[model samples]
Target: MSKSFERFQRRKLISSYFSVTLSIALVLFLLGILGLLVLNTKKLADHFKEQIAISVFFKDTAKQVEIDELQKSLVMSEYTKSAVFVSKEEAAEQHSEEIGENFLEFLGYNPLKNSIDVNLNAAFVSTTQVDSIAAEIGKRSFVEEVSYDRPTISLLTENVRRIGLGILIASAVFTLIAVLLINSSIRLSIYSKRFIIKTMQMVGATKSFIRRPFIWTNIKLGVFGALLAIVALFGLLYYLDLNFPQLGVLQDLKMLAILFSGVFILGLLISLVSTYFATQRFLNLRTDDLYY
Candidate 1:
Protein backbone atom coordinates (compact mmCIF):
# COMPACT_ATOMS: atom_id res chain seq x y z
CA MET A 1 0.00 0.00 0.00
CA SER A 2 1.16 3.63 -0.60
CA LYS A 3 2.42 5.35 2.61
CA SER A 4 -0.09 8.21 2.22
CA PHE A 5 -2.99 5.73 1.75
CA GLU A 6 -1.88 3.75 4.84
CA ARG A 7 -1.75 6.97 6.88
CA PHE A 8 -5.26 7.85 5.76
CA GLN A 9 -6.49 4.40 6.81
CA ARG A 10 -4.82 4.76 10.23
CA ARG A 11 -6.52 8.12 10.79
CA LYS A 12 -9.93 6.72 9.93
CA LEU A 13 -9.42 3.83 12.33
CA ILE A 14 -8.34 6.12 15.16
CA SER A 15 -11.23 8.51 14.55
CA SER A 16 -13.70 5.62 14.60
CA TYR A 17 -12.29 4.38 17.89
CA PHE A 18 -12.57 7.84 19.45
CA SER A 19 -16.14 8.22 18.25
CA VAL A 20 -17.26 4.89 19.67
CA THR A 21 -15.61 5.51 23.03
CA LEU A 22 -17.14 8.96 23.38
CA SER A 23 -20.57 7.69 22.44
CA ILE A 24 -20.35 4.81 24.93
CA ALA A 25 -19.24 7.17 27.70
CA LEU A 26 -22.21 9.47 27.17
CA VAL A 27 -24.67 6.59 27.09
CA LEU A 28 -23.17 5.02 30.21
CA PHE A 29 -23.32 8.35 32.01
CA LEU A 30 -27.04 8.57 31.37
CA LEU A 31 -27.44 5.00 32.56
CA GLY A 32 -25.44 5.75 35.70
CA ILE A 33 -27.78 8.57 36.65
CA LEU A 34 -30.79 6.31 36.34
CA GLY A 35 -28.97 3.65 38.36
CA LEU A 36 -28.25 6.16 41.13
CA LEU A 37 -31.91 7.08 41.37
CA VAL A 38 -32.86 3.41 41.55
CA LEU A 39 -30.24 2.68 44.21
CA ASN A 40 -31.10 5.68 46.40
CA THR A 41 -34.85 5.29 46.22
CA LYS A 42 -34.87 3.01 49.27
CA LYS A 43 -32.60 5.29 51.26
CA LEU A 44 -34.81 8.28 50.55
CA ALA A 45 -37.90 6.31 51.46
CA ASP A 46 -36.35 5.17 54.73
CA HIS A 47 -35.34 8.71 55.58
CA PHE A 48 -38.93 9.90 55.25
CA LYS A 49 -40.31 6.92 57.13
CA GLU A 50 -37.91 7.51 60.01
CA GLN A 51 -39.47 10.95 60.47
CA ILE A 52 -42.80 9.33 61.40
CA ALA A 53 -43.58 8.83 65.09
CA ILE A 54 -46.49 7.88 67.29
CA SER A 55 -47.41 9.81 70.45
CA VAL A 56 -48.50 7.72 73.42
CA PHE A 57 -50.20 9.66 76.21
CA PHE A 58 -50.63 8.16 79.68
CA LYS A 59 -53.78 8.34 81.80
CA ASP A 60 -54.16 11.19 84.37
CA THR A 61 -53.88 8.69 87.22
CA ALA A 62 -50.80 6.97 85.76
CA LYS A 63 -47.74 7.50 87.94
CA GLN A 64 -44.25 8.40 86.65
CA VAL A 65 -42.90 4.95 87.68
CA GLU A 66 -45.59 3.14 85.68
CA ILE A 67 -45.07 5.40 82.65
CA ASP A 68 -41.30 4.82 82.75
CA GLU A 69 -41.80 1.04 82.85
CA LEU A 70 -44.12 1.06 79.89
CA GLN A 71 -41.71 3.34 78.01
CA LYS A 72 -38.88 0.89 78.64
CA SER A 73 -40.95 -1.98 77.32
CA LEU A 74 -41.94 -0.05 74.21
CA VAL A 75 -38.31 0.79 73.54
CA MET A 76 -37.38 -2.88 73.81
CA SER A 77 -39.87 -3.90 71.15
CA GLU A 78 -38.49 -4.59 67.65
CA TYR A 79 -41.14 -2.32 66.16
CA THR A 80 -39.91 0.65 68.20
CA LYS A 81 -36.77 2.25 66.78
CA SER A 82 -36.73 4.96 69.46
CA ALA A 83 -38.91 6.26 72.31
CA VAL A 84 -38.61 9.70 73.95
CA PHE A 85 -40.48 10.42 77.19
CA VAL A 86 -42.01 13.90 77.29
CA SER A 87 -43.26 15.19 80.63
CA LYS A 88 -46.38 17.39 80.72
CA GLU A 89 -44.18 20.41 81.48
CA GLU A 90 -41.88 19.73 78.51
CA ALA A 91 -44.89 19.22 76.27
CA ALA A 92 -46.34 22.53 77.42
CA GLU A 93 -42.99 24.27 76.82
CA GLN A 94 -42.68 22.81 73.30
CA HIS A 95 -46.25 23.90 72.46
CA SER A 96 -45.50 27.36 73.85
CA GLU A 97 -42.40 27.72 71.68
CA GLU A 98 -44.22 26.63 68.53
CA ILE A 99 -47.51 28.46 69.20
CA GLY A 100 -45.79 31.59 70.65
CA GLU A 101 -48.01 31.44 73.74
CA ASN A 102 -48.25 29.55 77.04
CA PHE A 103 -51.70 27.99 77.02
CA LEU A 104 -51.07 26.61 80.53
CA GLU A 105 -50.71 30.18 81.99
CA PHE A 106 -53.87 31.30 80.21
CA LEU A 107 -55.83 28.27 81.48
CA GLY A 108 -54.43 28.48 85.07
CA TYR A 109 -53.07 24.87 84.82
CA ASN A 110 -51.03 22.53 82.62
CA PRO A 111 -53.51 20.48 80.61
CA LEU A 112 -51.08 18.28 78.64
CA LYS A 113 -50.57 14.63 79.54
CA ASN A 114 -47.24 12.85 80.02
CA SER A 115 -46.47 11.19 76.69
CA ILE A 116 -43.86 9.11 74.91
CA ASP A 117 -42.90 10.04 71.33
CA VAL A 118 -42.19 6.71 69.63
CA ASN A 119 -40.32 6.49 66.33
CA LEU A 120 -40.67 3.20 64.49
CA ASN A 121 -38.33 1.40 62.12
CA ALA A 122 -38.96 1.80 58.38
CA ALA A 123 -40.79 -1.52 58.12
CA PHE A 124 -43.18 -0.57 60.93
CA VAL A 125 -43.92 2.93 59.58
CA SER A 126 -46.48 1.64 57.07
CA THR A 127 -50.20 1.99 57.77
CA THR A 128 -50.86 -1.66 58.55
CA GLN A 129 -47.79 -2.22 60.70
CA VAL A 130 -48.16 1.09 62.54
CA ASP A 131 -51.74 0.29 63.41
CA SER A 132 -50.74 -3.15 64.64
CA ILE A 133 -47.97 -1.64 66.76
CA ALA A 134 -50.30 1.04 68.13
CA ALA A 135 -52.88 -1.51 69.15
CA GLU A 136 -50.24 -3.60 70.88
CA ILE A 137 -48.79 -0.58 72.69
CA GLY A 138 -52.24 0.65 73.72
CA LYS A 139 -52.87 -2.58 75.63
CA ARG A 140 -50.32 -1.46 78.23
CA SER A 141 -51.80 -0.70 81.68
CA PHE A 142 -50.59 2.93 81.97
CA VAL A 143 -51.24 3.87 78.31
CA GLU A 144 -54.34 6.00 77.81
CA GLU A 145 -54.02 6.52 74.04
CA VAL A 146 -51.57 5.91 71.20
CA SER A 147 -52.06 8.63 68.62
CA TYR A 148 -50.74 9.07 65.07
CA ASP A 149 -52.19 10.37 61.81
CA ARG A 150 -53.16 7.09 60.16
CA PRO A 151 -54.75 8.78 57.17
CA THR A 152 -51.67 10.92 56.53
CA ILE A 153 -49.28 8.00 56.96
CA SER A 154 -51.32 5.80 54.62
CA LEU A 155 -51.53 8.53 51.99
CA LEU A 156 -47.81 9.28 52.15
CA THR A 157 -46.89 5.61 51.84
CA GLU A 158 -49.15 5.14 48.84
CA ASN A 159 -47.79 8.19 47.08
CA VAL A 160 -44.17 7.21 47.71
CA ARG A 161 -44.79 3.62 46.58
CA ARG A 162 -46.39 4.83 43.38
CA ILE A 163 -43.55 7.26 42.67
CA GLY A 164 -40.95 4.55 43.26
CA LEU A 165 -42.75 2.19 40.90
CA GLY A 166 -42.88 4.88 38.25
CA ILE A 167 -39.15 5.52 38.56
CA LEU A 168 -38.39 1.79 38.28
CA ILE A 169 -40.43 1.56 35.10
CA ALA A 170 -38.76 4.62 33.67
CA SER A 171 -35.34 3.24 34.51
CA ALA A 172 -36.11 -0.01 32.71
CA VAL A 173 -37.17 1.81 29.56
CA PHE A 174 -34.12 4.07 29.71
CA THR A 175 -31.86 1.07 30.22
CA LEU A 176 -33.19 -0.58 27.08
CA ILE A 177 -32.67 2.65 25.16
CA ALA A 178 -29.12 2.94 26.46
CA VAL A 179 -28.33 -0.59 25.24
CA LEU A 180 -29.76 0.00 21.78
CA LEU A 181 -28.09 3.39 21.53
CA ILE A 182 -24.66 2.07 22.50
CA ASN A 183 -25.14 -0.85 20.10
CA SER A 184 -26.02 1.38 17.16
CA SER A 185 -23.14 3.76 17.84
CA ILE A 186 -20.62 0.92 18.06
CA ARG A 187 -22.06 -0.71 14.92
CA LEU A 188 -21.65 2.50 12.98
CA SER A 189 -18.07 2.72 14.23
CA ILE A 190 -17.53 -0.84 12.92
CA TYR A 191 -19.40 -0.05 9.72
CA SER A 192 -16.57 2.23 8.64
CA LYS A 193 -14.17 -0.76 8.54
CA ARG A 194 -16.38 -3.15 6.54
CA PHE A 195 -14.21 -2.97 3.42
CA ILE A 196 -11.11 -3.66 5.48
CA ILE A 197 -12.74 -6.79 6.87
CA LYS A 198 -13.63 -7.87 3.34
CA THR A 199 -10.02 -7.37 2.25
CA MET A 200 -8.78 -9.50 5.16
CA GLN A 201 -11.37 -12.17 4.31
CA MET A 202 -10.11 -12.30 0.71
CA VAL A 203 -6.57 -12.90 2.04
CA GLY A 204 -7.71 -16.07 3.87
CA ALA A 205 -8.27 -14.56 7.38
CA THR A 206 -10.30 -16.95 9.60
CA LYS A 207 -13.53 -15.66 11.21
CA SER A 208 -11.92 -15.69 14.68
CA PHE A 209 -8.85 -13.88 13.33
CA ILE A 210 -11.07 -11.21 11.82
CA ARG A 211 -13.23 -10.79 14.93
CA ARG A 212 -10.43 -10.89 17.54
CA PRO A 213 -9.00 -7.36 17.20
CA PHE A 214 -12.40 -5.70 16.88
CA ILE A 215 -13.76 -7.49 19.94
CA TRP A 216 -10.70 -6.69 22.06
CA THR A 217 -10.53 -3.06 21.00
CA ASN A 218 -14.23 -2.47 21.59
CA ILE A 219 -14.01 -4.17 25.01
CA LYS A 220 -11.33 -1.66 25.96
CA LEU A 221 -13.52 1.12 24.65
CA GLY A 222 -16.38 -0.08 26.86
CA VAL A 223 -14.16 -0.13 29.96
CA PHE A 224 -12.81 3.34 29.23
CA GLY A 225 -16.29 4.69 28.64
CA ALA A 226 -17.60 3.17 31.83
CA LEU A 227 -14.74 4.67 33.82
CA LEU A 228 -15.45 8.06 32.32
CA ALA A 229 -19.09 7.77 33.23
CA ILE A 230 -18.21 6.76 36.80
CA VAL A 231 -15.98 9.81 37.21
CA ALA A 232 -18.75 12.06 35.93
CA LEU A 233 -21.27 10.46 38.29
CA PHE A 234 -19.07 11.09 41.34
CA GLY A 235 -18.40 14.63 40.24
CA LEU A 236 -22.12 15.32 40.14
CA LEU A 237 -22.53 13.71 43.56
CA TYR A 238 -19.77 15.88 45.05
CA TYR A 239 -21.43 19.02 43.74
CA LEU A 240 -24.72 17.91 45.22
CA ASP A 241 -23.05 17.27 48.57
CA LEU A 242 -21.40 20.68 48.66
CA ASN A 243 -24.51 22.61 47.67
CA PHE A 244 -27.26 20.41 49.09
CA PRO A 245 -25.71 18.76 52.12
CA GLN A 246 -28.93 17.01 53.10
CA LEU A 247 -28.49 14.69 50.14
CA GLY A 248 -25.20 13.49 51.63
CA VAL A 249 -27.20 11.29 53.96
CA LEU A 250 -28.15 9.16 50.99
CA GLN A 251 -24.54 8.61 49.89
CA ASP A 252 -23.75 5.28 51.41
CA LEU A 253 -20.37 3.81 50.53
CA LYS A 254 -21.68 0.25 50.16
CA MET A 255 -24.47 1.19 47.81
CA LEU A 256 -22.17 3.49 45.87
CA ALA A 257 -19.66 0.69 45.50
CA ILE A 258 -22.39 -1.49 44.08
CA LEU A 259 -23.37 1.29 41.68
CA PHE A 260 -19.81 1.84 40.47
CA SER A 261 -19.17 -1.85 40.01
CA GLY A 262 -22.49 -2.20 38.24
CA VAL A 263 -21.66 0.61 35.83
CA PHE A 264 -18.35 -0.92 34.90
CA ILE A 265 -19.71 -4.45 34.49
CA LEU A 266 -22.71 -3.21 32.54
CA GLY A 267 -20.59 -1.16 30.18
CA LEU A 268 -18.10 -3.94 29.71
CA LEU A 269 -20.71 -6.64 29.10
CA ILE A 270 -22.90 -4.55 26.84
CA SER A 271 -19.96 -3.42 24.78
CA LEU A 272 -18.57 -6.93 24.45
CA VAL A 273 -21.96 -8.32 23.50
CA SER A 274 -22.89 -5.47 21.16
CA THR A 275 -19.48 -5.48 19.45
CA TYR A 276 -19.65 -9.25 18.89
CA PHE A 277 -23.09 -9.11 17.32
CA ALA A 278 -22.23 -5.95 15.41
CA THR A 279 -19.13 -7.55 13.83
CA GLN A 280 -21.17 -10.64 13.01
CA ARG A 281 -23.55 -8.53 10.92
CA PHE A 282 -20.68 -7.48 8.57
CA LEU A 283 -19.13 -10.96 8.69
CA ASN A 284 -22.36 -12.50 7.35
CA LEU A 285 -22.83 -9.84 4.65
CA ARG A 286 -21.68 -10.32 1.02
CA THR A 287 -19.11 -8.07 -0.70
CA ASP A 288 -21.91 -6.76 -2.94
CA ASP A 289 -23.83 -5.57 0.15
CA LEU A 290 -20.96 -3.30 1.34
CA TYR A 291 -22.37 -0.30 -0.56
CA TYR A 292 -25.60 -0.48 1.45
Candidate 2:
Protein backbone atom coordinates (compact mmCIF):
# COMPACT_ATOMS: atom_id res chain seq x y z
CA MET A 1 0.00 0.00 0.00
CA SER A 2 1.17 3.58 -0.75
CA LYS A 3 2.04 5.83 2.21
CA SER A 4 -0.92 8.08 1.25
CA PHE A 5 -3.36 5.15 1.33
CA GLU A 6 -1.94 3.93 4.65
CA ARG A 7 -2.31 7.46 6.03
CA PHE A 8 -5.91 7.57 4.80
CA GLN A 9 -6.63 4.26 6.48
CA ARG A 10 -5.05 5.51 9.72
CA ARG A 11 -7.21 8.66 9.69
CA LYS A 12 -10.33 6.62 9.02
CA LEU A 13 -9.48 4.32 11.92
CA ILE A 14 -8.97 7.25 14.28
CA SER A 15 -12.24 8.81 13.10
CA SER A 16 -14.14 5.59 13.73
CA TYR A 17 -12.59 5.22 17.17
CA PHE A 18 -13.54 8.78 18.04
CA SER A 19 -17.11 8.19 16.90
CA VAL A 20 -17.41 5.03 18.97
CA THR A 21 -16.10 6.73 22.09
CA LEU A 22 -18.55 9.62 21.64
CA SER A 23 -21.44 7.31 20.98
CA ILE A 24 -20.74 5.36 24.15
CA ALA A 25 -20.46 8.55 26.17
CA LEU A 26 -23.75 9.92 24.88
CA VAL A 27 -25.68 6.73 25.55
CA LEU A 28 -24.19 6.29 29.00
CA PHE A 29 -24.96 9.90 29.85
CA LEU A 30 -28.63 9.36 29.05
CA LEU A 31 -28.65 6.14 31.04
CA GLY A 32 -27.04 7.92 33.95
CA ILE A 33 -29.81 10.54 33.93
CA LEU A 34 -32.48 7.90 33.86
CA GLY A 35 -30.74 6.12 36.66
CA LEU A 36 -30.79 9.28 38.70
CA LEU A 37 -34.51 9.64 38.19
CA VAL A 38 -35.02 6.03 39.18
CA LEU A 39 -32.96 6.34 42.31
CA ASN A 40 -34.62 9.57 43.44
CA THR A 41 -38.21 8.73 42.59
CA LYS A 42 -39.08 7.72 46.14
CA LYS A 43 -37.37 10.78 47.54
CA LEU A 44 -39.33 13.08 45.25
CA ALA A 45 -42.58 11.42 46.27
CA ASP A 46 -41.66 11.57 49.93
CA HIS A 47 -40.96 15.27 49.78
CA PHE A 48 -44.47 15.96 48.53
CA LYS A 49 -46.03 13.53 50.97
CA GLU A 50 -44.25 15.17 53.85
CA GLN A 51 -45.93 18.41 52.90
CA ILE A 52 -49.37 16.92 53.53
CA ALA A 53 -50.04 16.91 57.23
CA ILE A 54 -52.68 15.25 59.40
CA SER A 55 -54.45 17.88 61.50
CA VAL A 56 -55.57 16.52 64.85
CA PHE A 57 -58.06 19.06 66.19
CA PHE A 58 -58.79 19.09 69.93
CA LYS A 59 -62.17 19.26 71.65
CA ASP A 60 -63.30 22.65 73.07
CA THR A 61 -62.84 21.31 76.62
CA ALA A 62 -59.39 19.83 75.92
CA LYS A 63 -56.71 21.48 78.04
CA GLN A 64 -53.26 22.59 76.82
CA VAL A 65 -51.61 19.89 79.00
CA GLU A 66 -53.60 17.11 77.32
CA ILE A 67 -52.89 18.50 73.85
CA ASP A 68 -49.18 18.69 74.67
CA GLU A 69 -49.16 15.08 75.83
CA LEU A 70 -50.84 13.87 72.65
CA GLN A 71 -48.52 15.93 70.49
CA LYS A 72 -45.51 14.49 72.29
CA SER A 73 -46.79 10.96 71.81
CA LEU A 74 -47.34 11.62 68.12
CA VAL A 75 -43.81 13.02 67.71
CA MET A 76 -42.49 9.76 69.14
CA SER A 77 -44.57 7.58 66.87
CA GLU A 78 -42.82 5.73 64.06
CA TYR A 79 -45.28 7.05 61.54
CA THR A 80 -44.72 10.65 62.55
CA LYS A 81 -41.80 12.46 60.95
CA SER A 82 -42.79 15.65 62.83
CA ALA A 83 -45.63 17.07 64.88
CA VAL A 84 -46.29 20.72 65.65
CA PHE A 85 -48.82 21.98 68.20
CA VAL A 86 -50.88 24.82 66.74
CA SER A 87 -52.94 26.81 69.22
CA LYS A 88 -56.35 28.12 68.24
CA GLU A 89 -54.85 31.60 67.99
CA GLU A 90 -52.10 30.40 65.70
CA ALA A 91 -54.59 28.54 63.49
CA ALA A 92 -56.74 31.67 63.30
CA GLU A 93 -53.73 33.76 62.35
CA GLN A 94 -52.78 31.32 59.60
CA HIS A 95 -56.31 31.30 58.27
CA SER A 96 -56.41 35.06 58.30
CA GLU A 97 -53.13 35.28 56.46
CA GLU A 98 -54.34 32.80 53.84
CA ILE A 99 -57.61 34.67 53.22
CA GLY A 100 -56.18 38.19 53.67
CA GLU A 101 -58.85 38.93 56.31
CA ASN A 102 -59.35 38.56 60.04
CA PHE A 103 -62.36 36.21 60.25
CA LEU A 104 -62.16 36.34 64.06
CA GLU A 105 -62.73 40.10 63.91
CA PHE A 106 -65.79 39.69 61.70
CA LEU A 107 -67.27 36.83 63.79
CA GLY A 108 -66.29 38.41 67.14
CA TYR A 109 -64.99 35.00 68.30
CA ASN A 110 -62.20 32.61 67.51
CA PRO A 111 -63.90 29.34 66.57
CA LEU A 112 -60.70 27.54 65.46
CA LYS A 113 -59.66 24.56 67.57
CA ASN A 114 -56.19 23.77 68.90
CA SER A 115 -54.60 21.16 66.65
CA ILE A 116 -51.47 19.15 66.20
CA ASP A 117 -50.14 19.19 62.65
CA VAL A 118 -48.65 15.75 62.11
CA ASN A 119 -46.31 15.14 59.23
CA LEU A 120 -46.05 11.43 58.61
CA ASN A 121 -43.12 9.46 57.32
CA ALA A 122 -43.23 8.77 53.61
CA ALA A 123 -44.24 5.15 54.15
CA PHE A 124 -47.38 6.14 56.10
CA VAL A 125 -48.58 8.99 53.90
CA SER A 126 -50.86 6.85 51.70
CA THR A 127 -54.64 7.03 51.95
CA THR A 128 -55.22 3.83 53.92
CA GLN A 129 -52.32 4.31 56.30
CA VAL A 130 -53.21 7.92 56.98
CA ASP A 131 -56.83 6.96 57.62
CA SER A 132 -55.78 4.21 59.99
CA ILE A 133 -53.42 6.57 61.79
CA ALA A 134 -56.12 9.22 62.04
CA ALA A 135 -58.63 6.72 63.41
CA GLU A 136 -56.18 5.54 66.02
CA ILE A 137 -55.48 9.11 67.06
CA GLY A 138 -59.15 10.12 67.13
CA LYS A 139 -59.85 7.61 69.93
CA ARG A 140 -57.93 9.87 72.29
CA SER A 141 -60.31 11.46 74.84
CA PHE A 142 -59.08 15.02 74.18
CA VAL A 143 -59.18 14.66 70.39
CA GLU A 144 -62.35 16.09 68.79
CA GLU A 145 -61.49 15.24 65.19
CA VAL A 146 -58.60 13.85 63.17
CA SER A 147 -58.67 15.28 59.67
CA TYR A 148 -56.54 15.33 56.54
CA ASP A 149 -57.15 15.79 52.84
CA ARG A 150 -58.13 12.20 52.04
CA PRO A 151 -58.78 12.98 48.40
CA THR A 152 -55.38 14.68 48.01
CA ILE A 153 -53.58 11.76 49.64
CA SER A 154 -55.38 9.27 47.41
CA LEU A 155 -54.54 11.24 44.29
CA LEU A 156 -50.93 11.69 45.29
CA THR A 157 -50.50 8.00 46.05
CA GLU A 158 -51.98 6.98 42.71
CA ASN A 159 -50.02 9.52 40.71
CA VAL A 160 -46.75 8.63 42.40
CA ARG A 161 -47.26 4.91 41.80
CA ARG A 162 -48.13 5.53 38.15
CA ILE A 163 -45.19 7.85 37.60
CA GLY A 164 -42.76 5.50 39.32
CA LEU A 165 -43.93 2.53 37.21
CA GLY A 166 -43.68 4.61 34.04
CA ILE A 167 -40.13 5.66 34.86
CA LEU A 168 -39.09 2.06 35.59
CA ILE A 169 -40.53 0.89 32.27
CA ALA A 170 -38.80 3.69 30.40
CA SER A 171 -35.51 2.87 32.14
CA ALA A 172 -35.74 -0.74 31.00
CA VAL A 173 -36.48 0.23 27.40
CA PHE A 174 -33.68 2.79 27.34
CA THR A 175 -31.25 0.31 28.84
CA LEU A 176 -31.96 -2.14 26.00
CA ILE A 177 -31.62 0.66 23.47
CA ALA A 178 -28.30 1.67 24.98
CA VAL A 179 -27.04 -1.87 24.59
CA LEU A 180 -28.13 -2.01 20.98
CA LEU A 181 -26.68 1.40 20.22
CA ILE A 182 -23.30 0.61 21.76
CA ASN A 183 -23.32 -2.84 20.14
CA SER A 184 -23.97 -1.43 16.69
CA SER A 185 -21.22 1.15 17.03
CA ILE A 186 -18.79 -1.55 18.14
CA ARG A 187 -19.81 -3.80 15.25
CA LEU A 188 -19.28 -1.01 12.72
CA SER A 189 -15.88 -0.28 14.20
CA ILE A 190 -14.91 -3.95 13.99
CA TYR A 191 -16.31 -4.23 10.45
CA SER A 192 -13.70 -1.79 9.20
CA LYS A 193 -10.94 -4.23 10.28
CA ARG A 194 -12.58 -7.48 9.13
CA PHE A 195 -10.11 -8.07 6.28
CA ILE A 196 -7.16 -7.55 8.62
CA ILE A 197 -8.72 -10.00 11.08
CA LYS A 198 -9.12 -12.61 8.33
CA THR A 199 -5.55 -12.02 7.22
CA MET A 200 -4.28 -12.62 10.76
CA GLN A 201 -6.36 -15.77 11.00
CA MET A 202 -4.93 -17.03 7.72
CA VAL A 203 -1.43 -16.58 9.22
CA GLY A 204 -2.30 -18.90 12.15
CA ALA A 205 -3.54 -16.32 14.68
CA THR A 206 -5.60 -18.08 17.31
CA LYS A 207 -9.13 -16.79 18.03
CA SER A 208 -7.96 -15.43 21.38
CA PHE A 209 -4.98 -13.73 19.71
CA ILE A 210 -7.26 -12.10 17.17
CA ARG A 211 -9.76 -11.03 19.81
CA ARG A 212 -7.35 -9.70 22.45
CA PRO A 213 -6.47 -6.33 20.95
CA PHE A 214 -10.01 -5.47 19.87
CA ILE A 215 -11.41 -6.32 23.28
CA TRP A 216 -8.71 -4.36 25.09
CA THR A 217 -9.07 -1.31 22.84
CA ASN A 218 -12.84 -1.25 23.23
CA ILE A 219 -12.55 -1.71 26.95
CA LYS A 220 -10.46 1.43 27.09
CA LEU A 221 -13.04 3.12 24.92
CA GLY A 222 -15.71 2.12 27.42
CA VAL A 223 -13.72 3.51 30.30
CA PHE A 224 -13.22 6.82 28.53
CA GLY A 225 -16.88 6.93 27.58
CA ALA A 226 -18.01 6.18 31.14
CA LEU A 227 -15.76 8.85 32.55
CA LEU A 228 -17.10 11.38 30.06
CA ALA A 229 -20.64 10.42 30.96
CA ILE A 230 -19.88 10.72 34.68
CA VAL A 231 -18.46 14.21 34.24
CA ALA A 232 -21.56 15.28 32.35
CA LEU A 233 -23.78 13.74 35.00
CA PHE A 234 -21.93 15.58 37.76
CA GLY A 235 -22.28 18.83 35.89
CA LEU A 236 -26.01 18.24 35.63
CA LEU A 237 -26.31 17.51 39.36
CA TYR A 238 -24.37 20.64 40.19
CA TYR A 239 -26.70 22.70 38.04
CA LEU A 240 -29.73 21.15 39.72
CA ASP A 241 -28.35 21.78 43.19
CA LEU A 242 -27.64 25.38 42.31
CA ASN A 243 -30.94 26.22 40.62
CA PHE A 244 -33.35 23.86 42.35
CA PRO A 245 -32.00 23.40 45.81
CA GLN A 246 -35.30 22.09 47.06
CA LEU A 247 -34.76 18.85 45.15
CA GLY A 248 -31.81 18.08 47.45
CA VAL A 249 -30.12 16.43 44.49
CA LEU A 250 -26.75 16.31 46.21
CA GLN A 251 -27.88 15.51 49.74
CA ASP A 252 -27.74 11.73 49.46
CA LEU A 253 -24.04 11.00 49.01
CA LYS A 254 -24.34 7.24 49.35
CA MET A 255 -26.92 6.87 46.59
CA LEU A 256 -24.94 9.19 44.36
CA ALA A 257 -21.84 7.05 44.87
CA ILE A 258 -23.78 3.92 44.03
CA LEU A 259 -25.19 5.59 40.91
CA PHE A 260 -21.78 6.74 39.69
CA SER A 261 -20.25 3.35 40.34
CA GLY A 262 -23.10 1.67 38.48
CA VAL A 263 -22.52 3.94 35.51
CA PHE A 264 -18.84 3.02 35.38
CA ILE A 265 -19.47 -0.69 35.70
CA LEU A 266 -22.26 -0.62 33.15
CA GLY A 267 -20.11 1.22 30.64
CA LEU A 268 -17.22 -1.21 31.03
CA LEU A 269 -19.46 -4.28 30.97
CA ILE A 270 -21.47 -3.26 27.91
CA SER A 271 -18.44 -2.25 25.89
CA LEU A 272 -16.58 -5.45 26.75
CA VAL A 273 -19.52 -7.64 25.88
CA SER A 274 -20.47 -5.76 22.72
CA THR A 275 -16.94 -5.68 21.40
CA TYR A 276 -16.43 -9.39 22.06
CA PHE A 277 -19.61 -10.45 20.27
CA ALA A 278 -19.07 -8.02 17.37
CA THR A 279 -15.55 -9.25 16.66
CA GLN A 280 -16.72 -12.85 16.96
CA ARG A 281 -19.35 -12.26 14.27
CA PHE A 282 -16.66 -11.15 11.79
CA LEU A 283 -14.28 -13.87 12.92
CA ASN A 284 -16.94 -16.48 12.14
CA LEU A 285 -17.74 -15.05 8.68
CA ARG A 286 -16.08 -16.30 5.46
CA THR A 287 -13.42 -14.24 3.66
CA ASP A 288 -15.77 -13.98 0.65
CA ASP A 289 -18.45 -12.38 2.81
CA LEU A 290 -16.25 -9.36 3.61
CA TYR A 291 -17.79 -7.36 0.73
CA TYR A 292 -21.18 -7.44 2.44
Taking all chains together, each candidate's TM-score versus the true structure is 0.95, 0.97
CA lDDT of every candidate: 0.89, 0.93
Q: Give a tens-digit lDDT track for model 2, residues 1-292.
A: 6999999989998899899999999999999999999999998899999999999999999988888888889989999999998889999999999999999879999999988899999998888898899999999898999989999999999999999999999999999999999999999999989999999999999999999999999999999999999999999999999999988888889989988999999999999999899989999999889998
Off by over 4 Å in 1: 1-7, 249-251
- Residue-wise C-alpha lDDT for candidate 1, range 155-261, written one tens digit per residue: 87998899899999999898899999999988998898899988898999988899999999999999999999999989888888889998872357887898889
Cand. 2 Cα-lDDT: 0.93
Worst 10 residues of 2 by lDDT: 63-72
